[model samples]
Target chain A: MLEIFARLATLVVHDLIGLEAGTGLGDAAHFFVEDTLKILFLLAVLIYLIALVRASLNVERVRAFLAGKAQILGYLLGSTFGAVTPFCSCSSVPLFIGFASARIPVGVTMAFLITSPMINEVAVVLLWGLLGWELTLIYIAVGFLVGMLGGAFLDAIRAERYLQPFLAQAYQQGSAAAAGGGEAQRLTLRQRHDFARKEVGEIFGRVWKWVLIGVALGAALHGFVPDGWIEENLGAGHWWQVPAAVLVGIPLYTNITGVVPVMESLILKGLPIGTTLAFCMSTVAASFPEFVLLKQVMLWRLLAILFALLLVAFTLSGWLLNLVEPWLTTGAGAGG
Target chain B: MREIKVLGSGCAKCNNTAERIEAKASELGVEARVTKETSPEALMQYGVMSTPAVVVDGQLVHSGSMPEPGQIQEWLQ
Candidate 1:
């Protein structure tokens, strides 16, 4: 598939535009252009499709669906909703309020919140395209586990008291309005098209700069970063590598789709699967901006705990994957 | 009269927000001009990173989701 892109890219850049393509610098330039186009195309199409699906629904339906479920069911449903929902992490606040006002437990809400950012369709699709099926499945499973367990842990500790007081007041206000019964209107096809076009523009416009930067960095790493140095320092066998990756990844703002190529390059430079994926997960799921936004509704202690939970879960997942990787490789060898 | 800017990417929620503001404004007997800003740059000008923000008279009144009718009414006044 990438070969097909490469051939088409060569025809356009080299044949049509008559640019250089047979040298090292040319290859790097081509790689960058190809990757950028690929990601942008993918982002535009997938985001538009997701927006189309999202356009047909309202928050009230999501609220009603999740309002009265048990803890485990809430965790399951919340995580699933988070997975498919097109919401950016910070933008999910209204849904968070809906859950709160509906009296859904804080843990369940956290489950929704965590998974929404961590394992959205963008991440899943990109991981599948770049990293293949096993890794993608692992990402999904770990994301779900983190949401479910993190939520349950928060609930077990009675974290509701840690919410900002205004959340309750706001929820009460919002709930009263909701209970008064407003009708949900269906959007016309033209309206859905316009909405999707606008959403595609918004998301693609915001993330394109990051995509270019990420691809450029990935190209550089692919070309210049040495394998031996990386393997010696941060290879799979290193016990501290997973936690270190998580800590470093926490401050970065790139999404999984943006980070996967860089990760692919790092893997070429001998970075471990566990460590690379750990970095990707934390970068997307545990960023500092997400915490800053949550502070509007949650006390610092609860936010800190939530961060810590993700940190621990990702680190453990990394270590466990590293442990099982050799066995999986051998199993594959035997089977295939 | 009020200048109500709905900071959204023109998604359903944002449209809903714009409509609700219009509804609330008329229901309360307030004459208001409602506009929707879909551009990221325009949204940033209002310091709204999230879509579907309601800005009334150039002050950001709400963001991060659809504003309820009551919240819209509260903000408009």
Candidate 2:
């Protein structure tokens, strides 16, 4: 269905615009049009549907649900909710304080926080659209694993001791009362439509530029890079490349919406899947700005620890995925 | 006079929420005092996990999104 649109666009560009097929500019133009249309269409539809389902879910209710749950179950549910929940980064501080004061385990809260950015609906939809299902499933599984294990490890080390002074005091006092946000009431169809429409507008407004920028970058690579150049230079999947890709991604900040398209082009160009995944994940999740935001809640030591933890997780997963690349890609190559 | 506090991390949306409330109050000829509360402590006190949450005279009334003009008019009244 979507390929038909790409083909139609290519026809229009080539026939009407007098651009020759197979030329760099022609291919780049076709790529930009096709990907931009596909991404925007998918994002709007998926976001609206997800928002309708999410109308009843909120951070307060999630806090109420996770509080006092069993340890392992708490982490699992926390990470699960993080994946499904629609969270804004601006609310992180308040959410952190609320969770901490409610006496939810620090690790569980960390699980939620870590998974929130890594496995959002936007990320899932984009990955599925750009990469094939096998890779998407693996990415989701890795995201959940990282969150769960990271949380458990933090708990084992008693990481709550590293909270900022005021947060520690709040935790000790347990000043938070019931975490509930009133009982859920069934919404009328009209209410759901309004909410979903607003959500589509808000989210689309925020991410459309990212989609364009990402697809444009992907188009540039698809157009200009010489064939077999990447394979000859970097396709060996050397173990050291994973860590280097991770380190390179640390300083650059972008969202998953902006990185998935780039990932598509990299894999198509013969870069190792694991190295590309590591670079993209690092770009999305591990960044200076996000850590700076967390500094409001966590002490410097804890922040550093979190940073190192993410780097290690991304590197390890990259390596593991690279080791299994042969089996993973036997039948499935990166899809458009 | 009513006191309206917009609680958030001082993001653009938070500022816009504060401005909207202030504009609505004056437009409705309702005497109101508005403030932007960026403190996490204030957010905790109100049990708000999202922002820009609205606190009218110490009572949290709405949260997690931008306020509509109609909602602001209702708040003022």
**Interface RMSD (C-alpha) of each candidate?**
8.9, 1.1
RMSD of 1: 7.2
lDDT of 1 by residue, A226-253 (tens): 5477878777677988998899988778
Question: In model 1, what lDDT does residue A172 have?
Answer: 46
- The lDDT for every candidate, in the order shown, is 0.73, 0.85
Judging by lDDT against the true structure, name the best candidate: 2
What's the TM for model 1?
0.77
Tens-place lDDT per residue, model 2, B1-77, is 99999999888899999999888888889999999988777887887888889999888999989999999888888
In TM-score terms, which candidate is top? Answer: 2
Query: Model 2: runs farther than 4 Å from truth?
Result: A330-333
Clashing pairs in 2: none
Residue by residue across A292-326, what tens digits does model 2's lDDT show? 77888899999988888888999999998888888
Runs of candidate 1 exceeding 4 Å displacement: A9-27, A168-185, A328-336, B3-77
